[model samples]
Target: MSSEVLVEKRKLKNPPLNIHTLGDRVLRQSAKRVSKVDDEIRELARQMLQTMYSADGIGLAAPQVAVGKQLIVVDTDPEEPANQPIILLNPKIRRHSDDLALGQEGCLSIPGVYLDVRRPAQIEVAYKDEQGRPQVIVATDLLARVIQHEMDHLTGVMFVDRVENSLLLNQELTKQGFSKQAVKPVEAA
Candidate 1:
């Protein structure tokens, strides 16, 4: 994420929403475009961050909380109190580097399982900030990886579905008590 801008943390009266699991139908639904950025959207973002922190996650999407909206929250450095979590509404990757990298990825919705997935090493994204202002971020490394991962969730995709290692994926899913059928591969073998 771009270092210049800082997102602020917010307090919420409502509790965090429940995160759905891999096989849940909610996670497979493609999220709709956010029509308007309102108080509700900001509130949802706040609750999502809370849920993400509660789950020890660095990122989350609205679909993970059963909301079919194109919104995502990400914060790679949760330990840094000043490192506020980002709230992106209707996020779109404007550009991505041709260079690809294999990174270990995990999901709060698919807890207990992590997998290696190949994705662009960097990206430029355009979206609306919490206040409905236009914002763009140039992200690399973990921030880049996290943004791509959460963006997948908005499109009915999961990290395990991108795992290239079938053996490790199967073993991990089994040990994690997740059904192998839950994996819907995006790439053809």
Candidate 2:
């Protein structure tokens, strides 16, 4: 085959997909914690952000792209340019408010599934920024929800696991005409 053909074939091989549904081992396994901010990690973050934007998603976890690392990219500004993406490495919620709010949450890993998950109205997060500098950000409302949702991926937790009502899950399945068996029970470690 010609070089051009080879390049095209490689591109076709890695075509993006809406990572809905479950059974992907990457989504189930706990991601490894990132230790250092190296060029590779930064590049990975950039690529992840590109993938998320291409997929028209608000956030993405490393595991979603089959990278078992504690890294996530989120961009919630609908009107702003996509160049500014938030990268979180070794992120941890330092504090969360007692006030809880339920919001419809979705995930790139679990496509076609959205449910009302209860989360804190506000949270203080300590994480490494894109430059690998340690930074703490106080997030509220949707931003807080995005942070909590992505952090769960690092611990092998999906939004469905936090559903407030089982009926909501069933309703989503019914709407999609997908059987309930699609969501397998997450095995205990």
Candidate 3:
């Protein structure tokens, strides 16, 4: 089966999946690797894409929807109908550039909270396409940052965890009706 999934990049009245928010235990649990790429996985990816678009998000992960599969859907240019969304199964960052960049990021799981986080500006990722064929790509800039951000969800890590400014994080979380305690801060590498 071709990895291409044809989904209109628009919000649906009701997305196929429910996106869990921050402080939800489901978001903190690690995702399991997909052993097989089949129709079931494809359908799940389709639903995830719909949910992401519905939530006005450029990327989404299975764990965000309370699924434990190591899957992620990303569409950086949703306005372009010709642009196909990326679906990766068990994606791994094979290599990263020494250079880093700070970019603001927001999550579907944690709505209304955008903060600056530093990440490698470029990365080489290896993963299986929707058809289960192994593939690799070197991504940079926005695409690289989005990929890294979504991949973090697979390991139960949220962008807020990487946020360095505690005051801003707390203010944003509070303003968004989220608790600061929900953030599990990670040390900068």
**lDDT rank, highest first?**
3, 1, 2
lDDT of 3: 0.93
Error of 2 at 176 (Å): 3.6
- Which residue pairs show backbone clashes in model 1? none
Off by over 4 Å in 1: 1-15
Give the per-residue lDDT digits (tens) of candidate 3, residues 41-75.
Answer: 99999999999999989999999999999999999
Candidate of highest lDDT: 3
Best by TM-score: 3
Clash counts per candidate, in order, are 0, 1, 0
**Candidate 3: worst-modelled 10 consecutive residues by lDDT:** 1-10
Q: After superposition, how far is residue 125 of candidate 2 from its true place, in Å?
A: 0.5
Write down the RMSD of all candidates, one decimal each. 3.6, 7.4, 1.0
* lDDT of the structure predicted as candidate 2: 0.73
Q: Stretches of candidate 3 above 4 Å error?
A: 1-4
State the lDDT of candidate 2 residue by residue for 1-189, as single tens digits: 111101111112334533434556667788998887887887787667656766667888887777889998877863465335578898999999999998898876666778888889999999987667788999999999998888888877877777757787988867866566546434221
